[model samples]
Target: MPIYVQMARCCWIICFLVFSSLFRAYEASPGDSDQLYRACLSQCQKTSCVGARCFSCCNSASDGSPLDASWYNIKHLYFWWNHWDCQSNCRYHCMLYRENERAELGLEPVKYHGKWLSRRQYGFQEPISVAISALNLVMHFHGWRSFSNLIYYSLPLKPDKTPFYDYAGLFNIYGLLAMNAWFWSAAFHFREMDLTEKLEFSSFVALLGYSIILAIIRSFSLRTDAARVMVAAPIVAFATTHILFLCNYKMDYEWNTKVCIGMGIAQVASWSIWCGATEHPCRWKLRMVVVGGIFGVVVKMLDFPPYQGLVNSEVVLNASNIPLTYMWWNFIKDDAEFRTVNLLKKVR
Candidate 1:
């Protein structure tokens, strides 16, 4: 490899580490950490208002019966989608009240509990991300379908009536897992909570680890079953153990960040080196994916604030991956096409 390629690879790895830091450890945000905000929250929880802008849910009973005797309040759409109970309602409205006061003094909106203040952010928080996640899921499905059709339909099959691609089933599983991860991601963005958070993390981690394994298997040409298993067993084991550590032991964001960064860098390095060395027709396509991933990370690192109070850093990040998804599936189709033809030539 050229010196420049080596340097670029190193820098890419560093950027990936920074990417993991986007999942920062939970901390109080500027608005939430303010003295006045806390005071307002306390008062609101007690009295259910800061002047006239009151939320009836704030004074609801412990069992969720409305204290204000407003029948429609409990049936409100925000409560249905956001699951905002009395206390959370109090915290949210108080934050908004404080932000309004600050805005009156010509101050900009600040984050409360690690989120930018927005009226639409209440129900189905991170709506843009949720939509993008769903789109990613759809793209994954489409990619998987295209790849499968290219192999099983577009190309000739072996005597047993299967695709000539050695890892056809493996890539199939990869596609399914990719779709599953995005499904959970959409769910998590739609309604974030402990359960959804775990589902999202576990699904994503599993896909990440599986992707690394696929990279290893493909890069090293582990064609035989034993050879592939020899390379994949340890990685699968480690990924499973890490998931257990998070789900059963502790959901430590910092530790998870380290694990993800390490695995992500490994995955990126594997693909980068292979793409550099391979004479394969689709090599440049894979390179584009890697470079595009780096560019996406750069965009994410430029996090200023949500654009027009709608799109956030994460929204852009997910959107960037959408094109890459199409590219990847396209690459997979081309790979299948080339592999079946090339290998058949060797046999002849």
Candidate 2:
């Protein structure tokens, strides 16, 4: 891993948490506060119409919420199941109408509530990001599947039937954590709700913190369980404390950024060093990943608005990860085989 992995993960978490913590959340475009947009919203709430387009949810409430609506109306609104209600429908329609007018007037598109305007597909609020996150999840599943097959099905097992590779279990857990993190990431991008946001933030931080501990274990070759636990205890403590603070107490964006930056830099540096020292066949892939990760970090730092009001910087960041992820998993597979073969030869 290089800077991009940590930077991408942290930036995604920080961008949302920071913006939400710092300002009033407007679910629509930055023009949400504009007099015209406000007036349009008010009219939509009262009349259930945005221009000639009318929404049934709006008819259920003056404020465009179904909180006071009858059961049938509530059921009707939730039937779509994409989490769309009167307020969101009104905001989406109004924002598009406003942006279309702005385009005609030659005005640039602006962010809404700290979010760049994004095109939604199949009810995904950020379709590109959601899709890419899902792809990343698939990559993990692929890697985990292949690795497990190689260990359990292809290779000879020990007396107790455990895989020959010493680190097999560790990497298996790693793959699971990676998959879990990506799943939450896709969900968060689909809709930035309180629960999804917390899970997305917590899952990645946990994964990263665990990765750092794993890096220490693998790089140092801490084979003994006690040695590994000694290396992990502090990291686990910090991660648990931070997650609790973020979820239970308050989300301290600045503090979290500092912690992630420090830990991420160390993790990348250690892996780069180990990759260089290791004579494994897949070391080349690890080296390539290191270089690419650094370049990606640089890429993520350059901030630009969504391209064509659809693909944003975050989506691009997620896309950049797909290849890195593939190569990294490939390296893990090779490493596992290499280690297993070495163990068998020792027995011989």
Top-scoring candidate (lDDT):
1
What is candidate 1's lDDT per residue for 150-245, written digit by digit as tens? 898879999899888988999999999999999999998877667887888899889988998888777766788897787678778877987887
lDDT digits (tens) for residues 232-291 of candidate 2: 887798779879988998654444544555555556666776775567677888888778
Worst 10 residues of 1 by lDDT: 15-24
The per-model lDDT (C-alpha) reads 0.77, 0.75
The number of residue pairs in model 2 that clash at the backbone is 2
Stretches of candidate 2 off by over 4 Å are 1-79, 82-115, 251-263
By summed lDDT, the worst window of 10 consecutive residues in model 2 runs over 18-27
Candidate 2 global CA lDDT score: 0.75
Relative to the true structure, candidate 2 reaches a TM of: 0.73
